[model samples]
Target: MNHWLTAPILIPLLGGILQVFMGYAPISLRRTLAIATTVLTLVSTIVLLVLASDDAYRLYAFGNWQPPFGIVLVLDRLAALMLVLTAVLALFCHLFAIGGTDEGNRQFHSLFLFQLLGLNIAFLTGDLFNLFVAFEVLLIASYGLLMHGGGRARTVPGLHYVVLNLVGSAVFLIAVGMIYSVTGTLNMADLAQKIPTVTGENLSIVKAGGMMLLVVFALKAALIPLCFWLPKAYARATAPVAALFAVMTKVGVYAILRVFMLIFGNDAGTLANLGMDWLFPLALITLTMGVIGALGADNLKTLVAWQVIISVGTLLAPIALGSTAGISAALFYLLSSTWTVGGLFLVADMVAQQRGSAKDKIVTAPRMRNRTFLSVLFLLGAVAAAGLPPLSGFFAKLLILQSAMAGPQMAWLWSVILIGGFFTLIAYSRAGSIVFWRTVDGHIEEPKPLGGNVSTAAGALIALSVVMVVLAGPISEYTDATAAQLQNPDGYLNILNTPMVGEDG
Candidate 1:
């Protein structure tokens, strides 16, 4: 059963390697292989999620080595949730790629599988070094996918994306080295156990390292000033790739929640809430910037990209509160935003394709092929993204608001969120009307048929948002339990540091 913890990662990793050898295979075969791989990964993740929900935690040791002595993987409620989400998103996005996007590049399927491999590993890893390794693996795979279609649009933003992430990687290494030098361990569980014992100069060094790690994670999460690279990079990337990349930002959020809370949280005494004072103000600014950018976006893709930033900011605002309720709200919001925003990207692409010369631009030269269908999707995606009622986003935001009321900065957080939602709704209204209703010259061109593939893929994603609303009670309860486990890290640490059965003898 413990070994099952590794299946989500191993399946895609092995699948990717097999995909590489099939370079000469037809595109359909490659698509089938990729889809099959993701489906298996999703099934494995669902099983793991179920197990984790019952068990609270599962730990796997490689090569029979124990704890900090060798590599290990952890599947807790949070990690399992993320893994299941990624697998689900990957499956649908892969289907969308098969609709036509994967044909542009021979390596898309292999790279996609490898991307899943990295994401699953990142979620499962119990060590900082392995987390960094996972980040690089996924990032390298993303670079290839971002430019799969090969255009100056992608190439230009791709370079900026590459450079920024490389720099983030460098900082990550520096931070990891600092932690290892001071605490003598890269295993997160060991670091948490050891972090409290450090004193004087070493404590300072650890604090510095922890702050640096936060910066690196913030960079990944695209916290304001560090976020300019995301819009163009995401907007230019193909729809399926961009949709999957939606989870990439949450990787940073997960790291911040997992590592920061477990390692430097209330239990750490003098080191508790080290940089939290700064996290809130910055997150609010990020929320404001994201809303402004979305409001002014000239194209639907760009608006959706800014929505990603908005989602990140919104989730973090609650997290910065550093309470169990805050974390629980953040987790729920995280799930909702990722799905809604991802769906928006897919819908925007589909609608853009049907608009001919206008593409996704706000100026509508013609009615979309499936105006009614696409309009409904766009409406659903828009309402969800805007945090309107009857969708997960509404409940997610409401939860955040409820959680934030206990915080000192409650007013500031509330104002920004409400105002941001207002602008978001306005932005969606503007884009929706132009893209779906109004025409540039007051004359609409004949609409074409939206292919079944695009509609299905995009519709599935939007439908998931609706599902989230329906399942809010169960999902929120799960997240609440997950956050409780996170706030009290004893179970996780006990599982990590306790020697395995045969090893103890």
Candidate 2:
């Protein structure tokens, strides 16, 4: 039962290796192989998520090694949901890339699987060092993806993205070294047991290590001060690439939820406690700053990038409140953000193609008396992203608000969230009217020219939007269960100690 858990992590590694070696195949065939592999990985992840819906969290060890000594990979509700979501986004991005990419490149396809491999491992790993390695894998892959177009637009931001990630990697390494020095063991469960009991000098070291690690994660997660890289990076990348990158930053949020909430436990997260006090304040500021940035941005792609930042602000709610409701809200937000952002990028890609532009560098569309068909869908997606009611985003925001209203001192940030939401709505509406609405600006391209193939890749993206709406109910239920697991970390012991039988669960 437990061994099936490793399949999500292993499948991509093996597939990526095979793709990289078969370098001699035609570019089209190579892409077909990559999409096929991504689909297979997606199937495995969905199976794992469904199988674990009712099971206790479990971990599978390689070569039958015990924890506090050997490596461990965990499969709790949170990680399972993320794994399935990552696979789905990766598959869409792969398909979307086929048409949305004007460059017709195959290398992006090969490296993307490695990127998927890294992310799944990061979500699953039970040790600090292994997690850092997984991030490196993701970073290396992103650099290639970011620079795929081989022009000034991609090249300039590729440098910034790489440098920023390198800094993040450095901070992550320092934190890992500090944790290992203080605790003599790298396994998460072992650290969970040993950390709470430390006193005086050792306790100070633990707090410092936690803070440093959180700082590193904040940067990766695109929270507040460290989020400068997100807008420009995502804006320059292709639309599908940006959608996939949205999943990338959440990796940090996932780490915080799994490590700080579960492994570090209540003692580290309490308001009166100084251990992890920064999460709350940082989240509020991030939410506000991200919304302001989103509203102020003049272009659609940049606006969408800032929207991703806003989602990050929401993701921190659970960790900040240090309560069950907060955890639940955070899980719900993670699910909603992934869906909304994925849909926005997909529609944006089509909108970009229709306008005959990329990154909204220039909106070559003409204005009409009413909105275009694709423009209407684009606005709807953006509105959903901003948390309008009856949408997945609305339910997600409602859950977080509910959590904050019940918790201590959290009600204050409600104003900030609402203000951010307002600007977000205004921002998307403004962009909607400008690029997608009537071409009153005298810059509208020929109207009613939906004459392209519409591409199978682009269709895959539209499929994702449908998935978000259709899967919302079931996903929301699973999110509630995810929160429950984080609030109580007991099953984590079972995950790490449980023996495997048929497949990696």
Estimated TM-score per prediction?
0.97, 0.91
Q: Give lDDT for model 2.
A: 0.74
Please list the residue runs of candidate 2 whose C-alpha ends up more than 4 Å from where it truly belongs after superposition. Answer: 100-104, 267-275, 357-371, 406-408, 440-473, 494-505
TM-score winner among the candidates? 1
lDDT of each: 0.89, 0.74
Clashes of 1: 0
lDDT of 2 at 359: 31
Candidate 1: global Cα-lDDT?
0.89
Q: In model 2, which range of ten residues has the least summed lDDT?
A: 447-456
Error of 1 at 177 (Å): 0.6
